[model samples]
Target: MEISRRRFSALGAGVAATTLSGTLSGATAAQAETPPGKPAVRNVVLVHGAYADGSSWAKVIPLLQEAGMNVTAVQNPLTSLADDVAATNFALARQDGPTLLVAHSYGGTVISEAGLAPNVTGLVYVAARAPEAGEDFAALSARFPTPPVTSGIITSGGFKWIGRSAFLRDFANGVPRKEALVLYAAQGLLSTAAPTTSVAAWREKPSWYAVSKDDRTINPDLERFMARRMNATTIEVDSGHLSLVTHPKIIAGLILRAAANS
Candidate 1:
């Protein structure tokens, strides 16, 4: 179901307020009792985009955990953008300390709208969509044409997504050929309706964006535009759409930076 512009605006406002409250509360608590020389804080919450589950983060999770930071990956239902946001928020609510909300592919839209969760001190976009209010994936793609690689997707109702071959070619292009093939074979069909995001979180949130210079799915130009508009700390990588998988170290470093700054 498409979220109306008005509804998305309302949701954005509510989420912003919720995030603000959380930020303020955390700040207040931090000021109450803290030694001057505290180590840099690091808490990460990862959100995967459409057609993928939390397992998409499997390759990167251990890396983050190994760095001595707490991490949580939200298993979004990929049902609707709002539903995904709610799931992300639920994960955020369960975390202790501050958080860096990271999004991949369509998860960018989810995090853009839901990053307002109180503990969300910052945001990291990994070759993901960061749409503004009233924007959908189709609208953003139109500005910078991306060769269509979704012809393999099969949907009974209104759901739309990429097929296995398309996933390997477009989504997992720069990844290891063998692993890309494996991921393509194990890919999930996503709800087409979820790409319609109602709110824009970049306008208010401090965000960091990772641009996949070799992305075959989302255009690199659009990634640059979204990052510029959000005034985000931007990092460019020569990877495909699944940079989080192929270049987890780079993505992790950016997340760690954001968490540290937060």
Candidate 2:
């Protein structure tokens, strides 16, 4: 079944389907079709996790562009799960053909809810939380030993973010110091409720995963469990939670592999 345009509205989040219109224009159907022998999926939509903006995908975007793929990185509002899913759905709605939906960190949750879009053909989770339908990610992650970054969270109002020191030391440890500093500076504050939404698009879609072996923010062990649970095509990389930033080449490659399969 398709994820309805009224999904968030049905949940009392008040997100209007018309909000998707601005991002919904794209290539004609013929131009959007994948060339023969190329990946069956021609569009790639990226969703960024908590404490990040779409710029979080900067490192991977050019690589995908160089490979001749149409790519769009979603700017999640980080206000709530429903809002983030709405933003992601807006991007997915714009794709003209088969599309590969990719997520990093908390973005995995957003894609899990939005990936049911009719044109979404596959999912790639990069060191992300992949909770099953009716699962509570916070409770799920709690089953694993708490990671270092958990202690660094600073909640203000209803939004949360890792402290700068923790963002650099625990979350983005694999990233270069200078770059990590900039990422920390641009971090988005995330709603605490996002993780409680239990939808699992990976359950219905062919999925791939890249687990960051050295991840301290989301527990590498938890990543493995989720990857296994989804029966995803999985790979492990030596990196921190922000693998998409620190290990873009392999992450992008995995995404390409998922796209090719579509």
Best by lDDT: 2
What is the C-alpha lDDT profile of model 1 across 162-251, one tens digit per residue?
A: 777787777778787888777766665567663665667677667888888888888888888888878787767777788778766556
lDDT of all predictions, in order shown? 0.71, 0.78
For each candidate, what TM-score against the reference?
A: 0.81, 0.84
- Model 2 is weakest, by summed lDDT over 10 consecutive residues, at 23-32
Which run of 10 residues does model 1 get worst, by summed lDDT? 25-34
TM-score of 2: 0.84
Model 2: how large is the Cα RMSD against the reference? 12.2
Looking at model 2, residue 262 earns an lDDT score of 60
lDDT of 1 at 1: 12
lDDT of 1 at 218: 81
Segments of candidate 2 deviating more than 4 angstroms: 1-39
Clash count of each predicted structure = 2, 0
